[model samples]
Target: MGYGLAVLGLLLVLSGAPAPAQTRAQTQESNDAAEQELRLPPIGSPAAEAMARYAIEREKKEYRENIERAQEVARLSAELQKAFEQRHGLFPDDLRKLERIEKLARRIRSEAGGSDGDDEGSDLPKSLEQAVRRLANVAKDLSERVEKTPRQVISASVIEKSNELIELVRLIRRLS
Candidate 1:
């Protein structure tokens, strides 16, 4: 072989380019990388391992969730305001003034939440299907809390998007 070819052949033999052998350390490293990606705890650790647990916990029990929920409520309120303006050039005269409507909105929202702990499943009105869907999603999320591991995390930042959807539901209910 030529000098270059000789060197190439020697390098290929040393590198085992024709055949592959995975060392134990290389295998362990690959496994570790996978575990990290999955948020799995090490062989021996006291703390929780998975990120999903944190996400579920943060979304409900944390202040971040409350803020997000409050923001969603604000967005729904804005949409209702806009729809009212579009429909009647400001709020309806019979719906009461802004301040009173705000008070009623708070009362009703609190009542809705408080009523969740009660027997709401039996008394949901058939006419409020749209409202029920939105509220069902909220309940679905809130009910999925992590009991063992709770940490603050945010999911998808989807409150605004949900707000737009709920706005349509709120409008439908107001009309019905």
Candidate 2:
């Protein structure tokens, strides 16, 4: 009877004993899981709501700024067209105007979630006159596209038009 009791106790002790390797691995995994859970606030929590609101506000502000930039681009393009009409060639401030247009176009593209796209070998203007006219037309079109695009939507057409306008501005700058 004493020997049988000793054997049963031994079996229970063995069963209860945790393997060192498995215990260590399980502990580490649980710790990592807990750390990951701590990183993000629970869904529907106040912290999550605040984070969402912040993101929405930031987007709204960016949209407003982009609209202003688009308006500026339109105004500058109109002025460039008028200057070209008056001077009949590259004006004194034509380079500056082209540079501004390029900068604005790049900003608009980035804000509209566009990357720098490759020039698709579109028909480039050859002469300074042709380049200036094309730049005006492209800039006007880009501005219109931006104004028409909704705040929540990223328009592929806006991105394409901005890229085209940027390329046209660069070409005009080179031609001048």
Candidate 3:
């Protein structure tokens, strides 16, 4: 295997290929250049430029909206965490909060045109599915907590669920 790798390296050197390592700025510059090229109007009409400007502004608006939604999700997850850590144990409001989280997740998935976790041929992305599964796991952990599990175990489970919720919200934010 070492010899094969050496041979491959030699071939790659001979081919004068550029190294794969790139700084973030370099990558961004390349991406920006590509985007600029793609935005060049085919007919070079003033109307085309106007349309491009409109599209760019619309995209900016959509991006801002998505960020707001992501913030809301994160806030909800934090609230859930606080509820889990309450001295009085799980309250009725906690269940209502969980329902809200589920609703937001479904709405996010729906916006991405994913199925509601029921259809056999669901076109949801793997990340979204994983997030949904994490949500389910959190619910299961909550049940365990409600069953009067040891304090340490319940705390640990809550921590894990909180992390999962954050990750799920992050995934939802990257939908666009």
Candidate 2 structure quality by residue, lDDT tens digits, 14-69? 89654444577786788899999879788899999999999999988988889888
lDDT of 1 at 147: 19
The digit string of per-residue lDDT tens for model 3 on 82-155 reads 55545334356655665576565444333333443422322333653344445455544433432343322324
**Top model by TM-score, which number?**
2
Please give the distance, in angstroms, between residue 95's alpha carbon in candidate 3 and its true position after superposition: 3.6
Instruction: Tell me the TM-score of each prediction against the true structure.
Output: 0.25, 0.72, 0.38
Ranking by TM-score: 2, 3, 1
- Model 1 Cα lDDT, one tens digit per residue, 1-176: 59998888789789855523656778678889998897755534554535556666664555444444444445444554555546643345423333332333333333233222221222233443434344444423332321112333333223323333334344445654
lDDT of each: 0.43, 0.81, 0.51
Which runs in model 2 stand beyond 4 Å of their true positions? 1-38
What are the RMSDs of all candidates, in order?
12.5, 10.9, 19.0
Off by over 4 Å in 3: 1-42, 87-92, 111-113, 117-176
